[model samples]
Target chain A: MSIPQQLILTFISGGIICVIAQLLIDLTRLTPARILVLYVSLGVLIFAVGAFEPMQKIFGAGVSVPLIGFGANIAKGVREAVDKDGLIGVLTGGLTSSAAGITSALLFGLFASFLFKTKSKRM
Target chain B: MDSKAKKQLIKKHSPSTTILKNSIMAFIFGGGICVIGQLLSELYSYFGCDEKTCGILVTVTLIFIAALLTGLGIFDKIARHAGAGTLVPVTGFSNAVVSQAMDAKSEGYVMGVGAKIYTVAGPVILYGLLSGVIYGLIYYIYRTVEQMI
Candidate 1:
């Protein structure tokens, strides 16, 4: 049952997310950038409040890949920063801790820009 | 006979041939990605970071590279060769941001710069979250079913 449970949920959940996303694109003015940031932050906030971990266990990358695992990294970074840098870590810890993800996101983004046709989708 | 014969000939063409092309492309491009990764590893050693730090450094460096390429309009070219093979990686993240930024910039500051920059990435993030939520619900259901079974 648990095995079937994972399959059914993965299919339905993943499908729902995609469908909702399509609707937003068709219906709303909100852009995907805000959505992306919101999700990562949401994950971070949820995990902080003990909400997202169970999701992480179930979906694996489904939970972590969007922000490229930075949410969990930021939380851990905050704790580390608190341990090492004291209060400043709260301010800077996310940057230093999740630096790898952010940095990779930025760099690979630049590299990919070159590798592909980055024509604006607006027009 | 002529029209039917042509139709039959077209039908004989398999989609797998296209898949085969893509699979080979994936191998080449995937290998390229790995090679770049390996080169980054070498650079990490040159800088004398421990193995752990080096791993972080490589990823961070790649992020910048991807961003820069996105800005310059070159990464897209490479992505062509790789398909999702390349796009699924960190480089794709960079492409998403850069392109979104460009799209947002057209309508002047408020709409373009402030609001529109997230057009592409917003959905990716949302889908990601919703997926997690659904994943959670599914897992919960699974647990219930297991208990019942």
Candidate 2:
């Protein structure tokens, strides 16, 4: 696909995924936290079925930007690890692959907490 | 009014959500975030990083920006309107961690910030890792069986 086309697909796919989450939020009692957990697990299950790659290929960051993509990444990491290191990869691969994202979030989050105070939501 | 009638009255009077409008906002905001990610990935790729490195960099950059916004109190403001638009992306994950930490800063570092930082996002990480392990084991067995056969 062309650059513009790929970007458009990314936008559409990302938008659609968020829309589904919105619908869940609006229509159901599921909290945002639960929904996020669900999405991540859904990503893992989708990958388990061997479908996440093609979806990523088409949607690009749309599929990859969500927590679902994170789940899939962990699964992917484990798979690769298992292949290369035998059974030990089952325990080591997921965190190993996701270390960059997880570590960055933790470091940046801690820094932000020091630099800024929380504001009460404006009623 | 009787209890049943009071319940009916309360349910009737409560303000209803603007579902259509919220969905539209979510789509726009969520899609916009992804577009930004795509652009960032492209930029990194142009700088000669491999695809995997670019993906990692894009996530790191997004998380950093999200953490900043959450700290500045801007992300929640936007999230008020964006709803799941803000909540569904990786940015939302960053917000969860940063917001929780900031909220608990009053209780000091270890007992407060440390304990509470993952209160919200812990499930995502925990379940994410759990499912990955489960799937990995399954995949390993399947592959092994395939090879044996």
Candidate 3:
């Protein structure tokens, strides 16, 4: 609730979330890409079950900044759209919900490509 | 001693990895990034945007910053230290795609940048959208049932 308390909670939650991913990377053969997808899908599932909102409320960016938060945002958007538009919402809701983030990434990414020369990673 | 046994002994005696130090670094760096996001959110709200729109603006700005960093090749250096700290944020997702596109630019244009753009992030987008549709259907059913009851 207070500023200091909020900071502490965000730090702990953010660290713990990263730790889980780090452990998965260190302990298993799962590639980072797979783990990332898993995180997103798991977030959506958690959100659907009505559990993610409380975590988001308490942790703030601790929960919201993570990829799971992104997934949850999509689900939240779809739910709102479905309420308003029915079956059609099911198809468009996710994209509409995250359109801002996705579109910005695409446009900025393309802009960066033109501005900066690519360097191959040394093998 | 045989070379294998000697190598094993050296590994056993090697100093343990500094998990605490790494975690502390991640916490600090990751928290710093999130704090930036929070500040942006506050700034947007102050500029008269509603809460939802403010969040969108913050996210768009972060994605832009992250993509720029990835293009400049600094994000990789930071990632080596920050690890999942950077990867956990939406910026990380932008970094993933942009870095891939940057790397593939060498091979050619279409098959290179355009095709490989989604290689790493493709699964995330696929699964994320899939989950959204699934959740939407379930929520729709629940709402319908609740109204009937």
Candidate 4:
């Protein structure tokens, strides 16, 4: 696909995903935390059904920028590990694939904590 | 007034959320973030990295930026208007960890920053990993069975 087309699809997919979550927040009692959990798990389920790759092929980063992509990444890691190492892959694959994300979040979070103070929300 | 009458009175006076406006904001900001990711991926690919590497690089770069924004106290302000546009992306995950760590700073580093860092994002990691493992187990068994047949 052309670069412009890819970016447009990414934006639409990402926007639609967020809109769905926004509607859930405004229309229901589900907290943001719960919605995050739901989206991530949904990603894993989509991967499990073998639909994640095809959807991603079309949606590009739109499907990836959201937490669901993270969930699918974990599942993808597990599949690769299981293929390579049998039972142990189930134990190590998820973390192995997600290690980059988890570690970056941790290191950056720590650095930010030292460099800046939390500000109270301004209304 | 009776209890039901009081409830009705309160409900009548309470302001309702403008759902349409919030949805439009979410669409713009959320989609904009993804476009940024796409651009970053394209930049990385232009530098000769393959698709997979570009994906990882884009994620890392975005997380770093999100952490910086959270530290600068800007993420939450944008989130106020963007709503799930910010919350639904990987950047939100970074903000969750950084914001919690910043809040717990008063409690000291180990008990405060270290332990509290994952308070919000913990469930995401925990459940994501659990589901991945479960899926792996099922996939393994299915593959093995198919091979035997």
Candidate 3 chain B least-lDDT 10 residues: B16-25
Tens digits of lDDT, candidate 2, A1-123:
987999999999999999999999988968999999999899989988999999998888999998888888999899999999988899998999889888888888788878998777886
Model 4 lDDT, full chain set: 0.92
**Superposition error at A22 for model 1 (Å):** 21
| lDDT of each residue in B9-75, candidate 4, tens digit only | 9989988789999999999999999999989988999999998898899889999999999999899
Q: Best candidate, lDDT-wise?
A: 4
lDDT at residue A79 of model 1 (Cα atoms): 51
Task: Score every model by TM-score.
Answer: 0.47, 0.96, 0.87, 0.96
lDDT to native, each model:
0.51, 0.91, 0.80, 0.92
**For all candidates listed, what's the TM-score of chain B alone?**
0.63, 0.94, 0.86, 0.93
Write one digit per residue (lDDT tens) for candidate 3, span B1-149. Answer: 89999999997998855666666666767777776776676678789999788778878888888998888778888988887778877878899888777777677768887788788677888899999999998888888899999
- Residue pairs with colliding backbones in model 3 are none
For candidate 1 chain A, the 10 contiguous residues with the lowest summed lDDT are A13-22
Candidate 4 vs. true structure, TM-score: 0.96
State the TM-score for model 2: 0.96
Q: Compute DockQ for each candidate against the true complex.
A: 0.10, 0.86, 0.59, 0.88
Tell me the deviation in Å of residue A51 in model 1.
22
* Model 4 chain A weakest 10-residue run by lDDT: A113-122
10 residues in a row with least lDDT, candidate 1 chain B = B14-23
